[model samples]
Target: MDWDKLRIFHAVAEAGSLTHAGDQLHLSQSAVSRQIRALEESLDTTLFRRHARGLILTEQGELLFEATRSMARRLETTAARIRDSEDEVFGDLRVTTTMGFGALWLAPRLPRLFERYPNLRLELMLEERIVDLPMREADLAIRMKEPSQADLIRRRIMEVRIRLYASRTYVEREGLPRTVEDLVSRRLIVQNPASPQVRAGGEFVQPLVAQANSTLTVNTYFGILQGVIHGVGIGSLPDYITAGFPDLVQVLPGLESAAIPVYLAYVQELRHNKRVCAFRDFVLEEITAHLRTIAPASE
Candidate 1:
């Protein structure tokens, strides 16, 4: 199989027009068409059918499309690894993390990472949205949810314990709740549910609060934590997030604690690549060691 012809076929299938594909690949439309024709000839099957607007993949093309997509991803990963190997381990390491984790945990610890690997350049992208790893949007991600993609590698870093907490001022003013029923009478700070399960939890938990009206509703957990810090209302926050805050008091200690698993995800094939591997192992070690230092004796 001619890799160049396959590349042209992939570009055409993706772009849906020879002209657009040619523009992207910096080749003439005629050259792109020729390559596609050669690929079809070699395969002895029609790959694409011409449409009024663009080209549509034929049934044969659909099968080839799947294989070609995988091939392209592998090729890109291989090329990136080759380029990385030739250069110093000093290139940018793009990381995506939730705002709370990045701000309270990862960001502070990054100085140590830099001290260890002085040559590695770090770019931290803090967001609530999970960046697309396979698209090369991010090199690594630390997320609350498990990645469902089979092509990506995922490791369970640790289980984060989330508990309802309030500032000392709020607790003193509102009076500490003796039971879950007491929560129903006080103001609550809540985060918008990122998943259906979290929404269900919110629905069940909200009824316990007396006011039912949340003082603040934000998309990110960090926002919820910040609101709690300013005496907004009782909010559920991860232990790791609140560990550094001196004034935050845990409310409903045992009843409100929920365990959420954290994960580290990256491209599967890039697992063996030197720089990627180094970062991956470094993160695992840092997070696991941190957990060990803070976790209860039983944990």
Candidate 2:
């Protein structure tokens, strides 16, 4: 149970090769191998199975690796906490959100954040998959719905609705659909029904997709937005995007999906982190500004 041996074993298990692990740890391959052997002798267990490709963890090694991974995350959390004890809002902050929102909304406003905190290192993970904040997968998350996870500090940011939109050129050529029934003959551009999306959005588009004469389905809303903007067809897009795209006209203005609530969340452990607080405040301020900008038009 030597801490140094455990550290080496964790690195080797992660790399799956003695030489690669040695390179990462700044130790010679032979030295790393010797340490591994000594650790195995002390534990009286074979931790890995060597093959032509590399080392594969034995069942016992897998269990040990899990523990080490948890330890590593805890150490990182501790380090982050210590760093945050300073008054400066500067350090690595990992934020996760859906690709569409990250690309379409948050990414565009990031310059303002950097202008305020030049030393802040931000890692934006844009993916459909939800990461585990409690496990330290990410420092923060902006999700389409309230998070169900325990020990999370979550706040509803805003509500978005899925509504039909078309570029000016497309509307000029094909004309607007006056009724739900009028949509039957028009080409529809939408997010693929099977893609990871909010339930309200998928439900709103399902009947439209079935009734359309032709369809273009993209997995991401950013792609769907592009298709709609370039005159591909009328598309179902979140209402939040319309302010950024003034040229997009509403199609069937009365028809809209149920509201999808957006939430910002982080683990309770990050409650006092200045970096997290700064980013959260920035997002809230942006949202308030966005709502105000769109208010006059909506009214």
TM-score, per-candidate, Cα-based: 0.63, 0.72
The runs of at least 3 residues in candidate 1 whose Cα sits more than 4 Å from the true structure, single-residue gaps closed, are 1-88, 193-204, 209-214, 297-299
Q: For model 1, how does the per-residue alpha-carbon lDDT over 32-145 read when each residue is reduced to its tens digit?
A: 999999899999999999999899999999999999999989889878856776434565788898887888888878777777678787888988776899888898888878
Which one is best on lDDT?
A: 2
Task: Provide the overall lDDT of each model, using Cα atoms, as 2-decimal numbers.
Answer: 0.78, 0.93
Q: Provide the clash count, candidate 2.
A: 0
| Global Cα lDDT for candidate 1 | 0.78
Tens digits of per-residue lDDT for model 2 on 155-186? 99999989999999998898888899888888
RMSD of each: 14.2, 12.6
- Among the numbered candidates, top TM-score falls to 2
Instruction: Indicate the worst ten consecutive residues by lDDT in candidate 1.
Output: 195-204
